[model samples]
Target chain A: MEPERFRELLDAYGGEEQRWPAEHRQAMRALYTGDSGARADVQRARELDLLLDSYRVKAPDLTQRIIDRVAPTGLGRFFAWLQPTVPAQWWRPATAFALPLLLGVALGLSDGSSGASTTVIDWELQEQALLSVTNEEPWYE
Target chain B: MQRDEENELVRRITRGDRAAFAVLVGQHQRALTNYTRRMLTDTDLADDVVQETFLRLWTQAARYDAGTARLTTWLHNIAHNLCIDSFRRSSRISFSDDADSTLESDDAPDSAEHSRERSDAVRQAVASLPERQRSALILCHYQGLSNRDAAEILDVSVDALESLLARARRRLKQLLEEFHGA
Candidate 1:
């Protein structure tokens, strides 16, 4: 790839890709064939990739304490523990049944002739969303 | 039935089945923490993010749509959002022009001469990458997520992932090459 195109990639990929522009991908992919000329460039990129891989930190230990504090040992009792600190209404679990029932209905609807037009609701999005919820970072969702 | 399994687990948890939720947490904790660590570059923040992630899961278990996506995807979505949230919460600058030049460090994780040399160079190169690029690369290259998956986790498109990855690689090579030359 030319220096100009390379620079464009830096500018383009430097930001988060969740909202990445479509045109940039088409343009970049066209030249990403690992061609002879691009070989050198890609080699350099790969080297960086390997190095970055080395630096990637190991995942933290997922012991019981971490899990306990996060998920809480018991919802009812835990919320009961928090009764003094938080509102009592917050612990109610109405949505637990309602939401899943609604989703189940959606799943049932997903089986009809309209399946072709229906979005699969890509697993990728769900993972992202749940991760967002789990991590307490609602904004990313 | 992965989605089905996840949804069932969620339902079980909602019914006050702590064991069911523990199973989910057990399944996801490592991946979630690793992804957060890669994104935040801070152990504490990663922990906080991971904790927040599960907390959300505990609460949102009901709202989750089983047919919409896989349990893993839902989990990733939670962690990704928090990473971004923590990133913004702190006033840390996103990139450092001087970050690449400081490739020297005394702490080394590898013992072999060749391993030490290369790993050290790579470590510095990764540390020097502009924060976002470093996060992107760590999750994709090191954490073993696909570019598309990383992009989704980071809330970017595949093209954007390639772009960030492309630049991250370019800068990493440039930095490592400089370290070796020295």
Candidate 2:
């Protein structure tokens, strides 16, 4: 690599060879090893890296704080417990079909024409009766 | 944490599994706190932002799509947003005084006072960077995120993210050099 390109890589990736892009690592390492000027560039980058390393922050008891803040409560907790244990793949499809299944069962139970076993003939008869009522002569006449 | 394990924990968290959430908190708290601190330059504010980030994770767990990004990246994105909010709030207040108070209390260990002084200088230099550059460095250099992930968190292209990193490092080098010379 040219000197300018080498400096740009060092600035972008820092002194650490491991942090450099994998494709450029072998060439960069060879260049750094074979050239004195490249070694100086690495040294400069290393100094900056060391300076950057000093900006550490300590996290004390933060886990408990976060837990307390996000802990589920009341109805949230109850619903969480009530959540099904079924695998998502199975439960999702089942849940998707559940409403329609319930509606069909409910319609069947509410049907008075043939008790709980209403047939297509029963539905047709009910439709005919409704039409006959509408078609009757007007009471005013 | 392994990707599969984290993904499983996220699923459990969506189900309101406190234990799973706690595990995730334990796993990422340090990195998140460090990132926030670097971004905001206040330990207390960083902790607050980190706390809010986890809380958001709990409340929005169902929104997490592992197919789009890793858990760490998602967490960083949340924390980054919180940090931005905090910055806006701080901007409304007297930031100079608050920063001074925070820096005063942020003293390092007494035994290493000299190193601590150097550290403080470096910290000040970092804190002086613009918000985006600081975030770019925190995500890529400190939090060890890949360029693409950091860019995603910042809502910028990878090339833009690299430019931010380059400018940040250049400015930091200049600041450190001036500090050392002084």
Candidate 3:
């Protein structure tokens, strides 16, 4: 690695050699051992690391709090009930049988509508009246 | 946590298993919270964001494709996105008021006051960084996430992430020098 590339890697990764990319580690180590300027750059990076470590936040143990907030409740429960767990394969056959049955029921209910049946009846009556008139007026005339 | 174990827990969570959700929470809460706290510099907001992160995991568990990334990387992605949202919603970034409380209470018996001052200066410098730079620093430097993982969380290429980290460190060094000089 060039001097500038080594500096960039040190700045980006940190002073620790292990944190540096594995592929470049051998080259970086050789440069570091051979060059005084590279050593200074690593030392500066380590200083920054020390400053960062000093400000480490004590992460609060909020596991239960997070659990409570994320715990499914009220509307969550409703959605939970609606979530399908059965495999799609299981539903495929069931849906196939159910879909045709549902279509038949829907057709039957639509066929039973009073307005449609009434219209059919009116058409049949007109046909019968025409037939009677025609039969009576035929042969003698 | 083992990848297989985490994956199994997530699978159970997808099935609406609360106990499994709790286990997952226990496994990752501290790391997530610390990452947020460092990024946002506000403990309360960090906590709120962390809670929302887990809640999102619960709600969006089915969207998790373990084939692509580890669970920690995925979780950090969610947390990082939420933190960005929080920043946009409120364009204010302030240091935590409680930042020095621990320093004050320390019984280190030497230069406690000096340590507090130095620590405060460092925190201010970190907080002063741009949002992306600060996130890159927090994830890689403090949280110990790999560059690739941090880039994934930040939605940037690894090269872009390294650029951000470099700028952040350069600025931090300058700021710390100025603080000490003052």
Candidate 4:
């Protein structure tokens, strides 16, 4: 590769710290070893790339609210459900989960001490329902 | 199972199969989690984003047309949207909150001792880049994706991705020159 083009390739793929895909390595290696100027440029690019790659920052874990916010939610999904024509079957289950989720929220907000009580009730109810379902269909059976 | 399994799982999800949705979640959660962490920086936020990302996958699985892109690309698209939003929200909290991250893994390969200073300089250079260029570099270099793939994921023209990287590299070189000198 010519010097300018070689420089570009290094910019694109030369860093060890930069995650070079396996398929690109042979081509990158070939370019790196092809000529002296090219080799020097590639070496520098690799060093910079690797160095940047080393300064790792993990994006914080997303909150459930954000996820719930992004995807069509109980109300958002409900509005979609309310369209003139009847909707698909899958939507009903989503709404089933969504409506209660919304109600749970509203209920939580309204009562002065509702937040703690509601969560406990919701948890217990879910536990009993889960236990009942599991009893109905044993894993080993 | 691999692609075939993913395809099957996708089909089942389309038919409203929650179990298949769970399987797909298990398969992709790790990557999505990692991607979220890289973009958001807060472990808690990353968890929420991952959860939300999967929930999106569950809901939108029915609409996923394989012809548009691979499962991975599609997932990255969802994650990217979330990442950008989070960055926007968090931008208010930290004015200079640019990339000065610690190493996530001990197994992070050998960069020499002096490598840390160079890396910091390069990171500062990278932080000075425009968002798109910074993202392109992160996706292409740090994530180790191909130019074509990174371009597609960035939803930019290939030439645009190249130009972005070119400018980014030039600026980085300039920044490092001054840093090294000083």
Candidate 5:
């Protein structure tokens, strides 16, 4: 490596050979071996590296706090259990089919497809229908 | 953690396994915290960013591609992006007022004091570097990431990352010299 190139790398990567780009390590070592000026530059870079090392980071552990926030709630956990463990490709077609079916079910419920006054029992039936549509196995016998 | 193990944990996590998520957090917490602290210079802010990063991991585990990058690289990428968002939110990066003290065990009081002063100077010098340069240095130097991985985190080419590292070192040396003649 040329002197200027060596200095540029020394400035960027510091004086540590391990930190230097693998492609140039042999050339850099050869240059440092033969050149006093290159050695001096490396020494200067090492000084800066050591100085930089002095600033050690001591951070607090926030593991549980993070975990608490991300843990699934009861409802989310229920849906999570329903999610397929198969490769994601299995779900794409399922989702495409399920979305239109869900929309149709919503429309039918709103339209009062039974042609009679809707009641609490009707709402329960609608909920069950939506749940059954979402999962392969029926929610009711 | 090995990539295969991490992949397995993530696979389990995708299936809503709390145990797997906790395991991932345990593996990366210290390294992520240390990287964030060095990048942001505030312990509280760094912790918040690290938390956000893991939360994203929980939500976005399906999006991660192990073939594209290691879990550490992916985690750092998430943390790095959040750090950038924080910079934008605050309209500027803030430097910590307190410099970190060295953990040397010295018998002589005077030598310890001198060592502390030098360490303080170095910390301030690093904290004062420009954002890109500081990120490049911290990812490659303190985090022990390879140049290619650090480059990916910074969204820069390896050559560009190297340029940033060089400039950071040059500026750091100047800053240290001005701070304490070190």
Candidate 6:
């Protein structure tokens, strides 16, 4: 690999060999061993990686809170009951799952918090662009 | 969990199977939470964002296309969008608020106080980055996401993602050097 290409890969994937793209790993290893400049770049990337790793997070469990907000009713509730009892794991298709649920059920299940509404509005504003991740529009400036 | 298992769980979740939903949550909550917490630098906001992400998963389970992206990448995309929304809604981005809460792990390379101070410096430096750069770095470096997946989440090309990562690291190096120099 050329010096510039090596530096780009180093910057993008960091100094860790394991994190390097598999296809380029062999070339990168050869360059790292033969080139002092590449080694220096790797050292810088390694230091940054160590610093980045220093920042950690311990998040609280929100599983119950999220589950409680689902609140299935009527047929949905029946299915919820029947789900465990069913033996064969038949699944509906991605298209079939798009059928809209009742508005009343949506309202009924609402946690009545601003979060749901805020998120809905956010999605609504970006719905056209968000449906596809490959959209060119940036999420933020 | 494996991709097949995640797909199955998501399929069950679409049918209102709370058990599968719970299982999915148990699998991803920590990583998702860590992503949001680092993005927002606020525990409560991160929790709310995560709740909203999973809630969307529960409600919009049908929207998920396994062919498009992996389960974890999709979830991170949801949380990242929410974090951006949170950024727009509020101007209060403080690194100090959650800096102390991090780096509580028992194994430290130095004294606890010194480690925390260094950790705080890193957090502040990361927080100071432009939103895109920070997301790029956090998703790829901290979240251990592949560049392709991170680019998809950021809605950028692989080259663009690399650019963001490179800029982020360069800026972080400058910031940290300045911090130590000070």
TM-score of chain A of each: 0.33, 0.46, 0.45, 0.36, 0.48, 0.46
- Candidate 1: what is its chain A TM-score? 0.33
TM-scores, all candidates, are: 0.57, 0.71, 0.74, 0.61, 0.74, 0.75
**TM-score of model 4 (CA atoms):** 0.61
Residues B74-107, candidate 5, lDDT per residue (tens digit)?
A: 9999999878777766766676655442234353
lDDT score, candidate 1, position B4: 70
lDDT of 2 by residue, A48-138 (tens): 8877776565556678766765546646643332333222224644665697999988887777555565445688889999999999999
Tens digits of per-residue lDDT, candidate 6, A1-141, equal 788899989988889887776788999999999988888978878877777777777777777776766666545543433232111212433223443545556776675643545533566658766666666678695
Model 3: chain A TM-score against the true structure: 0.45
For model 2, how does the per-residue alpha-carbon lDDT over B1-182 read when each residue is reduced to its tens digit?
A: 68999999999988879999999999988888778777876666677677767877887889999999999999999999878877776763222234423332344477356555666778788888888998888888888887778999999997788789889999998888854423
Ranking by DockQ: 5, 3, 6, 2, 4, 1
**For model 4, what is the error of residue A67's alpha carbon versus the real structure, in angstroms, after optimal superposition?**
12
Can you write out model 1's per-residue Cα lDDT over B45-128, one digit (the tens) per residue? Answer: 667677667766776688777766566777777877666666666656333233222223345445444555665567556656
Q: Which numbered prediction scores highest in DockQ against the true structure?
A: 5
Candidate 6 residues B1-182, lDDT tens each? 78998999999988878899899998998899989888988777778778778877877889999999999999999999889877877776855354566556675556666667777888888888999999999998989898889999999998999899989988888888844423
Give residue A39's error in model 6 in angstroms: 2.3
Kept native contacts, fraction for each prediction:
0.32, 0.40, 0.52, 0.32, 0.55, 0.52
What is model 5's DockQ versus the real complex? 0.24
lDDT of 4 by residue, B55-152 (tens): 66766777777777778778877777776777676663222334334434444346444455555556456656767777787677655566777788
All candidates in order of lDDT, best leading: 5, 3, 6, 2, 4, 1
Which segments of candidate 6 are over 4 A away from where they belong? A74-141, B95-98, B107-110, B178-182
Model 4 lDDT on a 0 to 1 scale:
0.62
Worst 10 residues of 6 chain A by lDDT: A81-90
Ranking by TM-score: 6, 3, 5, 2, 4, 1
Residue range with the least summed lDDT across 10 consecutive positions in model 4 chain A: A80-89
lDDT, residue A131, model 4: 89
Model 6 docking grade: incorrect
